[model samples]
Target: MSEAHEARISRNEEDIQDIWKVVEDIKKVLAARPPLWCTFLLMALSSGLTGFIVRAFS
Candidate 1:
C-alpha cells in the first residue's frame, strides 16, 4: 500500500479504538445503576411499610 493509505488506516484504527473506549466507559456506568435502583426501591418500600404500620397502630 502507499504511505498515505497506510497512514489513513492507522488513523482510522485509532479513532475506532478511542470510540470503543468511550463505549466501554458508558457501558460500565450503565451497568452499575440497576443495583442502586434496587436499593432505592427497597428503601422506599420499607419506608412505605413503616408508614402503613404506624397508621394502622394509631
Candidate 2:
C-alpha cells in the first residue's frame, strides 16, 4: 500500500486508542464518584429500552 494509506490507517488506530483510554478514564471516574439513585434509574431505563427493542424486533 501507499505511504499515505499507511499514515491514515496509523492515525485511525491512534484515534481509536485515545478514545478507548478516555472511556477507561471515565469509567474510573464514575466508579470513584458512584452516582446514587439517578444512575440506577438511568440504568433501569436503558435496560427497559433494550428489552423493548429486542422484543419488538424478535
Candidate 3:
C-alpha cells in the first residue's frame, strides 16, 4: 500500500482507540454513581423528617 494510505489507516486506528477509552471511562463513572431512586429516597426521607421536627416545635 502507498505511504499516504498507510498513514491514514494508522490515524484512524488511534482515533478509534481514543473513542473506546472515553466510552469505558463514562461507564465507570455511571457505575460509581448512586441510582436515581436511591437519591430520591434519601431526599424524601430527609424532607419528611425535617417537616416532622418543625411541626413538633410549633
In lDDT terms, which candidate is top? 1
Instruction: List TM-scores for all candidates, in order.
Output: 0.57, 0.60, 0.59
Question: Which one wins on TM-score?
Answer: 2
Please write out the lDDT profile of model 3 over residues 1-58, one tens digit for every residue. 9999999999999999999999999778767875965687789999999999999998
2 against 3, candidate with superior TM-score: 2
Q: Each prediction's Cα lDDT score?
A: 0.92, 0.91, 0.90
lDDT-based ranking, best first?
A: 1, 2, 3
Cα displacement (Å) at residue 32, model 1: 1.0
lDDT: worst 10-residue window of model 2: 29-38
Writing each residue's lDDT as its tens digit, candidate 1 over 1-58 gives: 9999999999999999999999998778768897887788799999999999999999
- lDDT at position 5, candidate 3: 100
Give the better candidate number (2 or 3) by lDDT: 2
Ranking by TM-score: 2, 3, 1
Higher-ranked by TM-score: 1 or 2: 2
Q: How many backbone clashes does candidate 1 have?
A: 0
For model 1 the local lDDT of residue 35 reads 82
Better of 1 and 3 by TM-score: 3
What global local distance difference test value does model 3 have? 0.90
In candidate 3, position 17 carries an lDDT of 100
